[model samples]
Target: MDVRTDEIAEQIYRVSVFVPHAGGGAGFTFNHFLIAGDEPLLFHCGLRKMFPIVSGAIRAIMPTDRIRWLSFGHFEADECGSMNDWLAAAPHAEIMHGVMGCRISIADMADRAPRSLANGEVVDIGGKRIRYIDTPHVPHGWDAGVIYEEVTKTLFCGDLFARLGDGPALTESDIVEPAMIAEDFFNLTSLGPTTAPNIRGLAALKPKTLAIMHGSSFSGDAEGAIHSLADHFEARLRMALR
Candidate 1:
């Protein structure tokens, strides 16, 4: 599957879409968010090659040098491998991650001390605000967390309600039935201890749209849909432990 990027918003942001061809047509999608601001923020930097993809997306949205924050969910390659590369590209962009991501990154990139983000901590992006919501075990990565923008009603969901598929749809209005999308979303839910509580933190924020790294994003009703996902995780967690 070819990775594609598009500017969907009213020129406020751009999404760098990555389609995983390894899924045998059951491909999955991932994204990195780009916007111009007093300091730009780039979410979910993809593979090594994706660095250029991210740069191009930013250039399309704002300018090649507009980024100021390069954030990721955890230390996963599908999400963060290009971070080091991003650091090199964007001189002013800071690498944002949780505790472990910082520790691991600091080991190699000692000069670049990442700003450790905790749940509910807000990072200023010019006039916009990006708050971190920690998700410990949605699929079992310790440093996993998500970023939410209150004013814009956007959630840079790490991997909370993910589905392994691909399409041109980028927002909620693009979907036919959102509930059906939720069902398929469960397909990506990792089987283990339930991670509902972690997801709940992000749910509480009432995000209008969720830019999930995999599958299509959740558009309208994002608040209720996210809570439902949180509920699903909690129930599964309870079931697993019992």
Candidate 2:
């Protein structure tokens, strides 16, 4: 596994760890997005075992201890597995997540108390304004949610548009098709009634950049890409019903 970091948006860095031959194809990437601001926020904790390398990657941009806010899309291992590890390193860092996540898991799982954000709650982290949206089971996880960086118009959507391979850190190409292909292979998303609607709600944000957790981060027509993904899942739901 090799970890590489790239700035996908203004002061927003995508730290990716690519593992070859792991996703039943070329490989997969466990990506973590670090938002550099007055109160720096690090999204996605990677895995507990990958702490050293992931932390090292983060250290390249800012000191590990300077991170002030920690959050992720869900409570998965790849998302917040290294929760305690980060708290141990960044003494001032506080774990933030959706209300249900904190009530169900984070409040107990985390080494320290967590701040639970209500739906559509926005937290000003210095130069960046992060809005947390509750999206339960859109991709997966009952406590699933996502954060939107207002200044950058970047949506830190976890596991949505997830695909296999070591694509560039950021691309302007079509991500919806590749994501659908990966969906056919992995079937990782929890397709249900709210799946398409939840994604469509995100499209309404009209994001210019999509900070994806796997594969590549997209920087072009983000709204269209998100809507297309919703359409695909809606079609799947129709097929499943038939």
Candidate 3:
């Protein structure tokens, strides 16, 4: 397992762990983002077993104890498996997630109470402000939601554009094809009626940077890429229903 860090966006760092042949012959990458701001935030905790690696990567930028916010798109092991570990490391850190995630899981699973954000709710972390967007069942989690950093126009979009292997830390290249390939193998999308609409809502943001969890973060024409994904999923759903 090789863990490395890169600054994918302004003040946003990506900590990626690459595991070769981990997913039954296909290699995989798990990513966590650290946003350095007034209240430093870490999005996605990686797996519990990888806490030392993730935490060490974080400590390289700032003291793990200085992390004020720990957040995720949904309640999953890769997303929040080290929730308690983080809470213990960062004494002042508080969990943040969508309202449903709070009610359904974080509230009970976290050692401390999580600050639940409703759709469109914004939390200011010094110079940067993050707005939460509810995206339930879009990527297969009922409590799923993504955050937009107002300053950088970066969307911390969890698994929306996930691809396989260890790709570039940040790329302006087209990721739609790779993402589609991963979708075929993982079938991570929900295919629900609301999925398309939810994706369209994210596209409306016109984000410049997409901070993904499972693979490389994407840059450039993020809105277009999102719409392309939405169209693909919508077509698949229509065909399946037919």
Give the winner by lDDT: 2
Least accurate 10 contiguous residues by lDDT in model 2: 19-28
**Tens-digit lDDT track of model 2 for 133-231:** 999997998899999999989999999999889889999999999899899998899999999999999998999999999989999999989989999
After superposition, the stretches of candidate 3 with alpha carbons farther than 4 Å from their true spots are none
TM-score of each: 0.82, 0.98, 0.98
Alpha-carbon lDDT, every model: 0.65, 0.94, 0.91
Name the runs in model 1 displaced over 4 angstroms.
Answer: 8-12, 18-20, 104-111, 173-194, 238-242
True-vs-predicted CA distance for residue 73, candidate 3, Å: 0.7
Give me the displacement of residue 35 in model 3, in angstroms. 0.5
Error of 1 at 201 (Å): 3.0
- Poorest stretch of ten by lDDT in candidate 3: 19-28
Note the clash tally of each candidate.
2, 0, 0
The alpha-carbon lDDT assigned to residue 214 of candidate 3 equals 79
What C-alpha lDDT does candidate 3 achieve relative to the native structure? 0.91
Instruction: List RMSD in Å for every model shown.
Output: 3.4, 0.8, 0.8
